[model samples]
Target: MDAATLLARLATVIDAHDWAGLPDLLHRDFTCRLVHTGEVFDRDGWVRLNADYPGFQRMHVEGLVADGDHGALRARVIGTSETGAELEFAVASFATVRDGLLAELVEVWADVGQDAPAGTRPQLT
Candidate 1:
C-alpha cells in the first residue's frame, strides 16, 4: 500500500481496536516514540502498550496528510478513567513508511481541554 493508504488503514485499524492487525501493518523493525512521555517502544512493546492501555474507548482521526513515504495524523481519543472521569486527548503522530509498512512513528499527546497558559493571552469576551 502507498503511504496515504497505509496511514488510512492504520487509523481504521486503531479505531477498531484490532490489536492483532497492528503487526501486519508494521515493519519488522518498527519503532514508536512517545514525545510527551519520552518513551520509546519497539513493535511488540508498542502493540502491548496500546492493547493494555487503561480505559481506551476509541480514537477519531481528525486530519491526515501524507507525502511519499511520510505521513502525519491528528486524532482525538476518548476514554473513561479508573476514577470514572471522562477524558479526551488530542494526539499528533508523524510516521515514516518502509516497504509499504509503518517503520517509525513519533506521537505527541495532550489533554484536550486544558486552558491556555495564565499569561499567554487574554480571554475573549
Candidate 2:
C-alpha cells in the first residue's frame, strides 16, 4: 500500500477499535516512540498499551500528510472520565513506512484542556 492508503486505513482501524486489524498495517518490527513518556514499545506491546488507556472515547485523525515512505499525522483525542468530565488532547506523530507498512512511529502528545460545548476537537492554529 502507498503511504496515504496505509495511513487512511490506520485511521479507520483506530476509530473503529479494530485491534486485531491494527498489526496488519504495521511491520512486524514496528516500534512506537512516545515522547511524553520517553519510552518506546513494540507492535504487540503498543496495542496492549492503547487497550488499557483510561477512559478513551475516540481518536480523530484530523490531517495526514505523506510523501514517499514518510508521513505525519495531526490528531485529536477525547475521553470521558467516570465523573462525566471530558478531556481533550492534541497529538502529532511522524511515521516511517517500510515494505508498505508502518515501521516506526514517533509521537508527541499533550492534554490540551477540557472540552467546551462545541466539542473536544483540537483547535489547529
Candidate 3:
C-alpha cells in the first residue's frame, strides 16, 4: 500500500477504536510521540492510551502531504467524553513508512475551544 492509503486506513482504524486492527498497520517496534505531552509510546503503549479514552466520535482528515517515504496528515477530531461533555482537537501527524507499514508516527495535537470554529485562528492579546 502507498503512504496515503496506509494513512487513510490508519485513520479508519482509529475512528473505529479497533485496537485489534492497529497491529496490522503498525510495525512491531513502532514508536509514537505525543507532541503535546512530549511523551513517547511504543505500539503497546499507544493501544493502552486509546483504551482509556474510548469515546472518540468523529475524525476528519483535513489534509495530507507526502514526500518520498514520509508523510504528514492534518486531522480534526470531535468527540464527547464518557461523561457526555463535548471536546474537539486538531492534530498534525508526521509518519514514516517502510515497506508499506507505519514505522513511526509523531503527532502534535491541541484542544480546540468549544466556541472556536474548526480551523479558526486563535486570537492573541
Best by lDDT: 1
Off by over 4 Å in 2: 114-125
lDDT by residue (tens digit), candidate 2, 1-125: 86777887887888788888888898999999999999999999988887778888888989999998998888898988889899889889888999999999999998886557675677889
Looking at candidate 3, the ten consecutive residues that score lowest on lDDT are 113-122
Per-model TM values vs. the true structure: 0.95, 0.85, 0.83
**Reference-based lDDT, each prediction:** 0.92, 0.87, 0.85
Q: How would you encode candidate 3's per-residue C-alpha lDDT over 25-109 as one tens digit per residue?
A: 8888889999788999998888778756766787789999887678899999988887989889999999999878888999999
Q: Count backbone overlaps in model 3.
A: 0
Give the per-residue lDDT of model 1 (tens digit) for 20-43: 998999999999999988999999
Q: In the order shown, what is each candidate's alpha-carbon RMSD?
A: 1.1, 6.0, 4.4
lDDT of 3: 0.85
Instruction: Kindly indicate the candidate among 2 and 3 with the higher TM-score.
Output: 2
